[model samples]
Target: MTTPQWAWAFEAADGTPVEGTVSPVFTNRFDAEQWLGQGWREMAETGIASAVLLAEGKVAAPAVRLSSDV
Candidate 1:
């Protein structure tokens, strides 16, 4: 079985950002969001925001009422 992960849709060269979730193509789900959050905080400390957590990938989290939002 494969595990799901959280990933952000990144654009090259300071372009627009799209909030999405995707697992690492070749690895297990290593809490992608956790790492992303940590990375983001670390960058914040260094004043270099290269990436942003567009979405939280929770394989088991509750879904929103898409009927209203979508």
Candidate 2:
């Protein structure tokens, strides 16, 4: 079986976490990244400020901020 990965979504305006923000377990990083790329914009509109990628339950890297500046 493939390894599992996760992502956490939070409000950028105040860092407040939204409920049901955790993504379904992904089998690979590429799939997880692609999902975020496609959905982050919608999340941002709903108050998601950034997304934190996790590998095996630990942080994979810094959180990705969804801003127009980037």
Candidate 3:
């Protein structure tokens, strides 16, 4: 079975919406979600965009693009 991949969406510090440019990041599938619970929480703090960690071809932890003010 094809393993799921992970991606980190980079964006400006401001709360402006940005285009998610998915690219090669982690070589190991496990590293894709290396952060575990901490990853999602970290992304939420950023607020510019999301850092999605996928597993079993599904989004296990998806950090939405929240307002930076948060």
Pairs with steric clashes in candidate 1: none
Worst 10 residues of 1 by lDDT: 61-70
Residue 36's C-alpha lDDT in candidate 3?
Answer: 35
Per-prediction backbone clash count: 0, 1, 0
| Residue 33 C-alpha lDDT in model 2 | 87
As a TM-score, model 3 comes out at: 0.34
1-70 in candidate 2: lDDT tens per residue?
7657565545455666667666767888888889888888788787777788888888897889886542
A best-first ranking of the candidates according to their TM-score comes to: 2, 3, 1
* Candidate order (lDDT): 2, 3, 1
Tens digit per residue, CA lDDT, model 1, 1-70: 5544345443223343323533243133346455654555443343332443333443233221111211
Query: 1-27 in candidate 3: lDDT tens per residue?
Result: 654455555454453435654435554
Instruction: Pick the winner on TM-score between candidates 2 and 3.
Output: 2
Residue runs of model 2 more than 4 Å from their true location after superposition: 9-11, 68-70
